[model samples]
Target: MSNIVSKSSILILGGSYFIGRKIAEVFEEYGYSVSILNRGTKPLTSLNIEQITCDRNDTECMKKALNDRRFDCVVDVSFKDSSWVENLCDTLDFETVKSFVFISTSAVYDIENLKIPFKENDKLAENKYWTSYGLEKINAEKYYTDYFASMNTRLIILRPPYIYGENNYAKRESLIFKHICESNPIIIPKTNPKLQFIYTDDLAKIINHLFKNNASGTFNVGNKKSMTARDWVNACAKVVDKKVKIIECDYKSLNRNVRDFFPFFDYDNVLDVRKINSIFNEETPIETGLSNAYKWFLDNKSQIAFKENIEKNICEILAKSN
Candidate 1:
C-alpha cells in the first residue's frame, strides 16, 4: 500500500536551532503539518510539531527512526558533510519525498577571488578563511544535487550569508547588543569592510515560498543592500536608543581572531539576490531586523551564552593605545 501524505506535510532536519527552528515555525504558522529530526539534546519549544529524536551521524539509528515515515518535502538544515547527505539519501524512500531543500552557506564561494555582489552561478572555491566548514558544505551541495538529479527528485539549494534575527545563538548581533546595552565603545577594524545579512524570518519566508512554488536551483539568498561594519554597529545602537562610541583600530593591532573581535571582517561578502527577489518580494530592512533582534536580546539576555570576549579585548586595545 502506498503511504498517504498531505501536500503541505514537511519534515525538517535539525529544526531545534536557529534557522531550522524558524523554518519549522513558519511552516506551522502556514498550517503545514511539521515534523523534525534531531538529537534529543535540545528540547523543541513547539509542542504541536512531531519530533524524531535520533543522531544523523548514526546511520543505522537514523534509518530506523525514519524507515517507514515519508513526507512531501524535506528541509535539511543539519547536513554538515557529504556523508550525511549520502546517508540520508541511502536511508529515505526518495519516491515518497518530492522536494529536498538544503540550507547551504555563502562561504561556499571563493572568498579570496570573489567579486562584489556574487551571483548564483559564480564559481565556488575552497574557503581558505573558514577552512573545512565551507569546503564540506560545498561537497554536501554537490552530493545533494547529483544524488537528487540521479533520483529525478526536486532539489533546492539556498546559500545565505550572515543570517541574523531573534533566537540567534551566534554572536553576530548579540555582541553588539551587549556593548550597546552596557554603553561601551564599539571597536571596529580600520578597513570598515562591507557586510551583508539576511534576516532569519525573511529566510524562512523564502523557504516557504520556494517550496510552494516548487522552485529548484542553487540561489544566493540575502538582502538587496549591503552595509559597512560601522553602519552595522550604529544600526544596532540606534535600535536600543543608545549612544555608541565608535573606535576604529588597525586589524593587525588587535592581535586576536577576526571572528572573535569583529562581527564581520574586512571583506565584501555581499550576495546577488536578484534571482530570489524576482520571486519573493518581501525583504526585511536591516534597521527593522536589528530593532527586532534587540528586542529579543533584551527579553532573553540572561539565557544567551555570550561566547566572545570582545569587550575585554577592546579594553586591552584601548590600554595599549594610551
Candidate 2:
C-alpha cells in the first residue's frame, strides 16, 4: 500500500490511555500533525502532539473543538457510549474529513464458537445480550458503519483482542509480569483457556497501516499467535528464571479479585487476524513482542507505580472483608 496519508492532521480521543498514547506516539513519529483530545488528567511530557481538552461525552464540548477546524482523520479511542458516537459523528460529519477510525474490541464477537482464524464474515451471535459497555460499542459501530456508508468518509473498525504492553491499564499482562518477578505462589484458575494478546505498539502500527492504505473494513488485530493462560504463565516464569508455584483454585475457592470474572477464564476468545494480514502485510509476532514487553517491565518495575496501586487495591479488599 502506498502512503496515501503522508502528512495528514489526525485527532485521537482518549489520547492519554495505554493504547491511545501509543497510537498518538506512532502517528507523531510518522510526521503526522497529531492532536490529542482527552480530559488532560494523564500528563505526558515528551509527546510533540497537540493536546485538546474536552469531555467527548459532552456534545457541546465536542462540537466546540471541531467547530471551525477539520482534521484529515479522527481515531476515536474513548468512544464508548452510543451517545458519544452519535454526537461525534454529528460534530465531524463533514466533507472535509477523510476517514474515521474506531478502536473497537473483539468482545463484540460471539464467544461461543471462538475457534482459530475467526474471519470477519464468520457467523456471530446476533441476538446475544451485550452488557452496558458491549451494547454501547455494538451500537456505536453500527452508527459509524451506516453513517459513513454513503459519505465519502472511510470508516475503519479495528477490533483488538486483549490489548497488552508496557503501561497497560487492563493489567492482563501484569498477571504474568508480577508472577515472574515475585516468588510467592500465583493463583490461577484451574481451567486452561486460550487467549490473544496484542502489544500496544503492534496494534498502533497496524492502525497506522490502515490509515496509510485508506483501508475501510472490520479487522481483528492482535498477535498472530495465541497461547493458553497456563502456557503463558509458565513461559514468563521461565524467561525471568523464577521458581514459583501455580495454585490452581476452583471458581468457588477464588478470592474476590480472582472470582469477579473467573468464569470467563475457561472461555476461548482468540481473535483471528486474517483480515488484517490481507489488508496489511506487517504483523507483530507474539514471542518477540512479549519478550520485549517483559524486558520493559523488568527494567522499569520500580518506576511502574504498581506499589501505590497495590496498596489502594489492598485497602479495597480489606474494606470488603469488613
Candidate 3:
C-alpha cells in the first residue's frame, strides 16, 4: 500500500455505487487517502479505503460521522435534493476542504429549444422528461454554488449526458447487451437523435484532474464527438461480435411510451466537452467504451437486474409489423 498523503485526502459520498465507485478506485490507485461515506446497505467492493457509514440525508448522522475528518476534496455523487446539499454544507467544515465537486446531470437543460452541443453558459431549465430529478438537481447546484461561495471553497460542477461503464445500476448498456446476446431484434424510436456518453472511468479522471488543478466552474463533460442512436446501437452490437437487426418504429404506431421502452432517451442531450477536453485529452472512443461495458455485462449478467420489459414488447411490435 502506498503511504497515505494528507494533501491528497479525499472523501466521496455514495462511493459504493457506479460512478462514485470508479472515482474511489482511481483516487486510491493514485495513492490518495480515499474515504467513502454511505448508508452501509450496499457491499463495499473497493479494498484499502476508509468507509464511513451514515445517511447523507440525516444531517445529524453526517455531522457525527464526518465532523472531525477534514479532506482536501469532497466529491459528492449521491445528492438528489437541494436540502441534501444544504445539510452537507451546514455539517462539513469547509475551512479545510479545498474543493467540492458535484456530479450533476445534463437533464438540467431545457431540451425543448436546446441547441446541440450545449456549452456551460447555455440556458438551463427543468428537464421535462425527468421533471423532478432535473428540478432538484438545478436547486442543488444553486445551493452548492451559494454555500461554497460564502466559504470561498472551489466548486466544480460536471453535467454529463449518459454515464455508462462497469457496475452501472441503470439498465442502459446491459439492456442492449442482453437482447444482442439473445439474438433478439433491437427496437428504437424512428428518430435517430444524437446522444452522448461518458465512460465512468473517464469521468473519474475528470474529477481527479479538476481537484488536482483546483479548477472551478460549471463545465459540460462528454465524448468529443456525438453519435446518433443508430450508430450507438450498432457499436454495441459490434462489441459483442454479434449481428443484430435494428427495427425503428414510430412510437405512436406502437402505442407505447418510447422513452420507457427504448434504451436511449428521446432528447438529443449532447454536451460541448471542449472545455474539459482541453485540460485532459483522454477521450475514450465509443467503440472501446461500449466494448468494455458489454464485457462487464456479460461477466455479471446474472447479477444485473433488468428494469424494462423491452424484449417482450419489442417482439410483439415486430410481429405486429410483420
Query: Using lDDT as the measure, which candidate wins?
Result: 3
Expressed as tens digits, the lDDT of each residue in 184-260 for candidate 2 is 45555666667777778877788777777777888888777888777777766765677766655454442444434
Residue 4, candidate 1: C-alpha displacement in angstroms: 20
Query: Which lDDT values do the candidates have, in the order given?
Result: 0.84, 0.71, 0.84
Model 3, residue 232: C-alpha shift (Å): 0.5
Minimum summed lDDT over a 10-residue window in model 1 is located at 1-10
TM-score of 1: 0.94
- Using all chains and alpha carbons, the TM-scores for the candidates as numbered come to 0.94, 0.84, 0.95
Query: Which residue pairs collide in model 2, if any?
Result: none
Error of 2 at 97 (Å): 2.1
What's the lDDT of the predicted structure labeled candidate 1? 0.84
Worst 10 residues of 2 by lDDT: 254-263
Instruction: Order the candidates by lDDT, highest first.
Output: 3, 1, 2
Candidate 3 lDDT at 127 equals 65
Task: Indicate whether candidate 1 or candidate 2 has the larger TM-score.
Answer: 1
Residue 269 shift from truth in candidate 1, angstroms: 0.7
lDDT of 3 by residue, 1-322 (tens): 3323344889998888799899988888878889998888777776688889998788899889977788889999988687778888888887888889999999888877778878888887876687899888888888888877777679999999999998889888889889889998888788877888899989988888887777999988898888888888899999989998988878886677775468767778788888888888788888888888888898999998776466667767878767
